[model samples]
Target: PVPVFKSELTGLTLPANAEIIAEGFIDPNELMDEGPFGEYTGYYSGNKGKDYPKPILRVERILHRNNPTMWSTTVGKPINDIHMIQSLNRTATLWHDLETMRVPGIEGVYIPAEACGRFWAVVSVRQKYPGHSNQVGNAVIASTTGHYGVKGVIVVDHDIAADDWDRVWWALSTRFDPKRSAQIIDRGRSTPLDPGLPIEAREITSRIILDACTPFEWTNKPNEIFMNREVLQKVSDRWNDYGFDGASPVANMIDRLVKPEAIKTKKK
Candidate 1:
């Protein structure tokens, strides 16, 4: 658990280990025009024609630890620390939301930092009934973490890890039919920082959900091919005998396990 302290000025509890803390209040009626600063989208936010109106925080007092270290992050485009942070936080938040909503058979959830962390998500689900994959896809868009900013979702089978791009592409190629598995919704809450939408119409956005799992209701499902376990083990065990420079790739195939039912709720 994180240590906490009560602020003497605002009577609010805060993290005791923080490097710096400011006791402040924002007046509801007060507004100020803020910037066109560079955003995580790799483009400048706000407009030259219309300065964005934002509430200003009036600092009453500031507190800091001795020899405080100021932490900062760079946010721009994809694959940055900010994007990575956003992906991690969003993925965990989405998973938590799904667990709280009792959405079963979820194997994994991943929001790639390459998609700016807010636009696309991939989910792997174990389909237990007809239309189960579709239900999970829709649930992702409706979740608290996904209802805002997310534009696309890809749902795959349990055999595919959400973060494994190779398997994700393979599933899309072999199992998906655009006409049968794609869903397009026209209305969802949007973030103003989304450059895809017009500045004046940034409050609403469209979403697309692509289901890549095979239909659970089908009577004749395609058989999945797999290598013989005994043969694979033998080959891996004798890898060095073949004058290989490194260990067999099969030696590193420890499966990742995530139990949705065991997820704990985050404290406020």
Candidate 2:
């Protein structure tokens, strides 16, 4: 269980084991000029290095534990701690929101840290019927976690993981038909810090949703090529016969794609 205590300054419950707490109040009338700080987008967001007026916070009391430690991280560029946190948080939130909305057939969701976490999202869905792929794509944009900041969404088949970039690209190349798959929304809530839009028009932006799943309505669907499961098992069983390092090569994705009866085993 977690420990807690009441703050003398505000009579509010606080974490007793906290390193430090600075009680403060934001005065709406008191404004201060704040500068262009580095943002998660790897660029300065506050008026391109110019100071902007912001509400002022006044600290009235302070509390701390022994050897209190203060933690901080720089928010800039991709593959950083901030980007990773954004990815995990946004991904989980998107999945949760979709689940709460009772959107069916959602398999996976991923917010890539390389896309600044907020700009792009990839989703995997098992299409259930005609227009199911479109439903999922629109649902992503309407989700609580995805309604803001996200500029693009790529919806793929359940066979691919949302985080698998290679398979995602493959699906985009093979399954995506621009005329049918592309959806462009001209109006969206934009973040004020977004550099793509002019400072004056930062309140609105565009969004695009790309559906990469094969149409569920098609009766004569294209047969996907897959390796024979029997052959794969034979190779795994005879790994020692071949000169290779470590255990048999892991092919989790391939294994999932291939069914024993789907393709015939090649004659040895």
Best by the TM-score measure? 2
Task: Estimate, for each residue in 99-165, the C-alpha lDDT of model 2 and write its tens digit.
Answer: 9999999999998999988889999999998998888878888999888988999999988889999
lDDT of 1 by residue, 106-198 (tens): 999999999998899999999999999999989999999999999999999987899999889999999999999999999899988899999
lDDT of 1: 0.87
TM-score of each: 0.79, 0.83
**Candidate 2 accuracy as TM-score:** 0.83
Tell me, by lDDT, which candidate is best. 1
What TM-score would candidate 1 get against the native?
A: 0.79
Report the number of backbone clashes for model 1. Answer: 0
Q: lDDT scores for all predictions?
A: 0.87, 0.85
Q: Which ten residues in a row have the lowest lDDT in candidate 2?
A: 259-268
